[model samples]
Target: MTGWLVRDAVAGGLAGAIVGGAPSTLHALLTGRDPLAASYAAGRMVLPSEQRPARLLAAAVLAHGALSLGWAVPIAAATPPRRAALFGAAAGLAVAALDLGVVGRRIPAIRALPQGAQVADHVAYGVVVALVCARRRVRRG
Candidate 1:
């Protein structure tokens, strides 16, 4: 049970890193903002001019990745593999609600994101996590 959970988490985290980061990064790039800097803003980290770009980017990715892996556990445990993506969509909305309605109010960094962008990024997170988890289960089974 422990090993299974660990494997699932690792898979989810990897998928989340790619899925969650890509759209947000693209949005930032298209808008002329540095993605890493935006991440730092979301995290409420003070981005001093002296901070190394690589370190800031890593911090951002790590933050989003951690949340993705955590959310994956519930979906993996409760949802059927075939329907995981559907549940993932729901999960994404839940995340959006929590982030936009609750966490965002408390965290200025999160609130900094345009509401529409936040929703899209979260949906991407859920869909990717579901797909990756389902694929991993199919391969193993």
Candidate 2:
């Protein structure tokens, strides 16, 4: 049980990071904004005054990965085998509300991001996490 849970979290986290980031990344590219703006902002949470691009990028990846994995745990645990997508979507919206509406309001960097893109990214993350959990359950059974 523990092993499967870990597997679900890891798989979902990794997949979610990629799929979840798409909307904001694409939005930034299309708008001629920095595609990594959100990443850089996340990095700033740790190194607030750092200016080196390489260091910021590294920090961003680490922060994002950690956050993805952290969020996946609860999401994976709560998601039901049936109606996983619907559960995931609702969970995503809740996450977005907390992450964007509440937490983002406190962090200037995060608060500055495009709300629509961020919300979409979070929703994507939740959906991917839930789907991964559901798929693993099916495979195991």
Candidate 3:
């Protein structure tokens, strides 16, 4: 049981990071904006006044990965096998509400991001996590 939980968490976390980050990154590039803008913003949470881009990017990746892993546990555990996608999408929206709407309001950097992109990313994260968890369950059976 513990092993399954750990595997689910790790798999879901990786999937969330990839699926969640892609849209924003692509949007930034398409809009002629810095693709790393979101990463920088995430990094700012830890290194609030850091001016160096490299350090900031690194911090952002680490932070994002950590947060993804943290969120994956609950998402993986709670997602129902049936209609997992729908549940994931709803969960993602809820996560966005808390992470972006509530908590983000407190963080200037997070607040400054494009709301649409961030929300979309959160939704993607949720769906991917759910799908990953569901897929794992099917394979195990």
Candidate 4:
């Protein structure tokens, strides 16, 4: 059980870092914005916006991975692999509501971006994490 948990966390984290962060970063870059800066602004809850150095991109990526892993643990434990994708999408919606409805309203930096983009990014996160965790579970079984 402990090993499975660890595997899930590590897998989810890596998936979130790559599958989740890459799209948003690329989108921000293509739109003529600094990826790290955008990430800092959006994720001010984890890392402050003031420290928006390019070097901090690694930290931001790691933070996303960590948060993804944390979110994955309970979801993995609670849901079966067969329903992972659906549950993951629901999780994404919940995250979107919390972020846009609550965090964005409270945080000026985060509110600067379009709500739609954030929702898409969050859904991407959920789907990637769900797929990764499900794969891990299936492989183990």
Candidate 5:
């Protein structure tokens, strides 16, 4: 269990960096910074999906969902009831964007695409990660 948590933390944090930092990369590139700067600056490897296998990806998924729960619950609790739903919605979208855009292999072209396409990509990442993590928990039996 201890080993799992440690691996999950590293995997998830790296995954989070990938997801959250994509925008930083885009921001850098749009402003004329080295495109590879984001890749090295964050201490993240940014490896290709083909290089990662099912279980490692599953660990990453679990880590992301755990991070999402940590963010969402607190925001919901802190916001006013009337505004809680909106807050949750925005948080969910932000999580999806971070996870999908950088961590789950979405490209910056999302900003160029239709809004629905962007939403779909992020939502897909969230949903798949949720499913993979759930399956992993069951498999640990």
Candidate 6:
């Protein structure tokens, strides 16, 4: 039970990293700062996964992180918390919509990161897979 929670938190945080990376990157870009340099500093939410044996579990974590990333900080970066929350959810939904658009479609040989995406698409899949499996376990229990 504890392990599952730990996994979720870590997955949540990694998702947080993805969530936080964008606006932080945007901040850096507009200011002519190096986005990579700020990646960890601003994107410190991702922690190492505790559930290594479960592949699908990890991938869901990635997707959750991606979903979280698409929503979280950027909305709150400059606006009021309430407004940020609304915008964050909107951003999350937009990203989710995009994911829905391409989730099963093959990318041929390579899945390139979009112009401002911080992490690669494949890596995100791995994390998301883990998260998904974890969720299934939670449901079963």
Measured over all alpha carbons after superposition, the RMSD of each candidate to the real structure, in angstroms, is 3.1, 1.3, 1.2, 2.8, 12.1, 15.6
- In angstroms, how far off is 104's CA in candidate 6? 42
In candidate 1, stretches whose alpha carbon ends up further than 4 angstroms from where it belongs are 45-58
Q: TM-score of predicted model 4?
A: 0.76
Worst 10 residues of 4 by lDDT: 49-58
Per-residue alpha-carbon lDDT of model 5 for 92-114, expressed as tens digits? Answer: 47765664466535433223333
For residues 1-141, could you state the per-residue lDDT of candidate 3 as single tens digits?
A: 488988998999898988898778878888897888899999988888997999999999888999899999999889898998999999999999998988788888889878888898998999999999999988998
Give candidate 5's whole-model lDDT.
Answer: 0.41
* Cα lDDT listed for each candidate: 0.69, 0.88, 0.89, 0.68, 0.41, 0.40
Off by over 4 Å in 2: none
What is the lDDT, from 0 to 100, of the residue 106 in candidate 6? Answer: 32
Error of model 5, residue 73, in angstroms = 3.8
How would you encode candidate 4's per-residue C-alpha lDDT over 1-141 as one tens digit per residue?
Answer: 588877786777567546765666677778887666546764565566546555455555566566667776765565467877787777767777876788677877667765666777777777777777888888878
Each prediction's TM-score versus the true structure: 0.78, 0.94, 0.94, 0.76, 0.32, 0.29
Clashes of each: 0, 0, 0, 0, 0, 27
lDDT of 4: 0.68
lDDT of 1 at 19: 74
Candidate 4, residue 58: the lDDT equals: 57
Ranking by TM-score: 3, 2, 1, 4, 5, 6
Tens-place lDDT digits, model 6, residues 49-89: 32233443455455445545333333223222233334434
Question: On a 0 to 100 scale, what is the lDDT of residue 128 in model 3?
Answer: 94
**Roughly what TM-score does model 6 have, to 2 decimal places?**
0.29
Which candidate number maximizes TM-score? 3
Q: Between which residue pairs do clashes occur in model 3?
A: none
Candidate 1 lowest-lDDT run of ten: 41-50
